[model samples]
Target: MNPLSRIRNFSIIAHIDHGKSTLADCLIQTCGAISEREMTQQVMDTMDIEKERGITIKAQSVRLSYQYQNETYILNLIDTPGHVDFSYEVSRSLASCEGALLVVDASQGVEAQTIANVYIALENNLEILPVLNKIDLPAANPERVIEEIEQTIGLECNQPLCVSAKTRLGIRELLERIIMQVPPPKGDPNAPTKALIYDSWFDNYLGALALVRVKEGAIKKGQRILVMGSNKNHEVLGLLYPHPIKQQQTEEIACGEIGIVILGLKSVTDIAVGDTMTDFKNPTKEAISGFEPAKPFVFAGIYPIETDKFEDLRDALDKLKLNDSSLTYEPETSIALGFGFRIGFLGLLHMEVIKERLEREFDLSLIATAPTVVYRITQTDGSTINIQNPSELPPEQKIAKIEEPYVKATIIVPSEFLGNIITLLNHRRGIQEKMEYLHETRVLLEYLIPTNEIVMDFYDKLKSCTKGYASFDYEPYEYREGDLVKLDVRVAGEIVDALSIIVPKSKSYDRGKELVVAMKEIIPRQLFEVAIQASIGNKIIARETVKSMGKNVTAKCYGGDITRKRKLLEKQKEGKKRMKSIGKVNLPQEAFLAVLKID
Candidate 1:
């Protein structure tokens, strides 16, 4: 194939609010992939949560045709999620691309996620094209940003494109750079089929639709192919590019081409991200490397507010798993929440997205349990067990030792808030690793802290302490030997074991106190007095009491008001339906979430 004819595959990557999706929309519109009148802002962000949250939660792809100097070229555009929590997803997106458009905010310069993304691009050996975005902002400093990019990324940019996606400035020049700098895909068109599954999703009518970049050989619809990773054969039923579906009778998909194939598979388990597909009859050694499945760091129990919607919740989770393979779930029975599923997620963002989708897409009312981290337990026999639920934790006698995961956190804050942020981190048992100046107005502080300490409301606390100017990024670090104790919550002196968690001793006092206070506000006043206590091995560290109240009744009732009294009782019954009865205390859904946070 001609070098120029080889299609160039690339994606736009940046931190949240850095204009990745906006740039995609502008590029697609300019390429005539979508009409200007029909164009929508952040077109790649198709999910409802993505729109409401103003962030891309899932990666999306589109194909475009760009003409530069009378040469028409095919550009496969992959839009990647910007959050660090979805770093695994971002890696899968990058695997499909040969080059990447690194968009950085001109005024904000470089962020933690921006640096992380640049490192990933470099690791993948992708040709990086630095583009300074938000150039129209009042604080725009393109020259300084270019210097920072070159110094930090160690890449020489010859006249880096400066553009405002909002204003459509310098977009044409960026397109020209893409054609000049990014090399087109190259592979043998006549070799046996070899393709990489960049992304896969379940289609209601078509089953599994895999977004693939044909790295080598040709593939045709109706051809029997085997996914080399699973060694399962599948028949391609349909083929599609970015637009309308085309007949599969054509010769075959050549190398360096991006397209979709319906593998007529029932479940998405057969085809996974980073897996390779090839012809079964004549197998090649060109199988694509697979990234390890992202382990869910947080676990929560999801229950239906309406008990009758139990099956509905299950179906919703099943559908969600089709799109997000990172989400894991299993049936769980809670004494307080009849029947539910213990759901696991990559991080808090992943959990939030799942919950939002269940509520919005499935239109189901849900009650979620407090999120917990998986604990590693060492038995008396020296065998290790990983426990996700407190109920699954071994009895105190059988466990020899236990360890919780830790994280190396990097927080960037304004100079003015450095003292406040440092104090907050210290309270959370964070040991200062280092602190350095990022710029005149900003500082980067590093700390080694337990994952459990920061998993709950840590982001919110950081924002509040920093006046919403601090940004944080964390990666899992090695666990260290520390004092670990199980903090349990008790109501009316009866231990609620489900609420118990293994926390570091250094953080137990403050965390316990905060939880008890929040629970007091959440747990409503009951007919019987209830005492809420946070304890460790029979030792109470914090306590709050809920005073008992008399029966709620009207002081006066007249003959005409008899009907009103009946209506009042009916409303009371309706309210009681929403509350979960634990002994004599009635707990609302908010109480569970309140206990999950530190403040």
Candidate 2:
């Protein structure tokens, strides 16, 4: 094959809603990869959640052929997730690309995430081709955005391409630019077998499917290969490209090419991101440039509403883990919710995506406990255990010392909300680290706070305080000793173990009071009076009481007014029958969520 005719691998990257997906669709359409009628908005956003949320959650790949100056070039485009939660995934996607099309929203200019994406791309040594998108929008200002990109990102965007993806304007030119700028993969086809695992997922029928980008040599079907990182050997069953209709089996997948390998491996974890694939007979000691596994900072318990479907939940989680390597789960027994899994996630979005996938794909109703961070606790015997659940804490006497995870949080918000944001952070036991100005209107505030303080509803609270104009980014700093207390929630005099949390004293009152009120509204009126209390050890910080109900009348009437009163009594009796007799009131799923949300 002609080296110039070979495929050029690249990926589109940008902040959320910055037209990365839109540009991908335009590129595919302009390159005639898909039919014009099939050109849907955000075509790469195949997941329902991704489409609904107007953001790409999963990375998708597509193949396009562009005729640049009569030379046909294979353009392999990888679309990556834009959210900060999937930074690790983004990094993996970037590894597969030799170049990156940095799509910047002409109107919005450069966002914090854009900067992050550009930095990652540069770190990967990817040739950056900055493209300004959404040029048709009313607020589009390509020139100003290009200037900002140059100033902030320190890139020379001398003539950044301005294109309206919606109008199909300058799209062809952009494709031509990609062909000219991005270099074809450079690898020795005659060298020892070497490939990079850019992404992998499990297939129900074929087992583990790895999206491998061959960097050197050739990978052939029926060849025994070793997953360099795991030292595991597997036989390749087949190969596939982006063409959905057909599975193409070639004699060999040469250098600079992207294809899927059906390695009859039973487990998805065998082929990790950035792992090198080599022929088992001749292996190399060098490891691929793969990223470390993303550490999950937030932990939560997931339970099914129907106890009998616990196995279904487990199966669902198994399937989810195949696709999302970041989600970690282990069996846990809850005093209130029975057997479930204590799952760890990178962040709140990761947690929600897993839960949503479980419910949507498996059709199971789930109840999740409030998220908690891992706490390092030292026992009197000097043994340390990481406690993710408050209920796992040992007795006060047994605990010699406890340290909670802390993060250095950087929040960029409008200047007007600086005072309010600071006050809220202080309430959460956040100590001021530094405060700087991003621009005249934006303030960059940094704080070192306990991870547990910001794990639950803290993001929501921060957004609420900043009026949705703030962006928060955090990295784990270290675990530090803190003045923390366990806040136990009680309903009908029985403690709800799932509702308990360990929080700093400064924010305990507000958190406890808010949660108690939320529980009171959602716990339903039982036959007996229910008291909702938030207590720290022996002290009660807040309390709310749900009054018990009176007996329902169901007797018949004979006369006119007596008949009406009797009818009303009968209705009351029916209503009481509908109410769940948990000592007396009816509780629904909504109530459960309400209690969890403290709304």
Q: Assess every candidate by TM-score.
A: 0.90, 0.88
Candidate 1 TM-score, C-alpha based: 0.90
Pick out the ten consecutive residues of candidate 2 with the lowest summed lDDT.
579-588
Name the lDDT value of residue 193 in candidate 1.
Answer: 87
Per-residue lDDT of candidate 1, residues 258-369 (tens digit)? 7788877777888888888898888777677665667788898888988889999998988888988778899988776688999988888888888988998999999887
* Clash pairs, model 1 backbone: none
Native-to-model Cα distance after best TM-score fit, residue 301 in candidate 2, in Å = 0.9
For model 2, how big is the CA root-mean-square deviation?
Answer: 5.2
Residue range 445-501, candidate 2, lDDT tens digits: 779988877766788888898887777777689989876778888765567677788
Worst 10 residues of 1 by lDDT: 242-251
Runs with alpha carbons beyond 4 Å of true place in candidate 2: 2-6, 243-249, 414-420, 431-439, 443-449, 551-599
Q: Which candidate is the best by lDDT?
A: 1
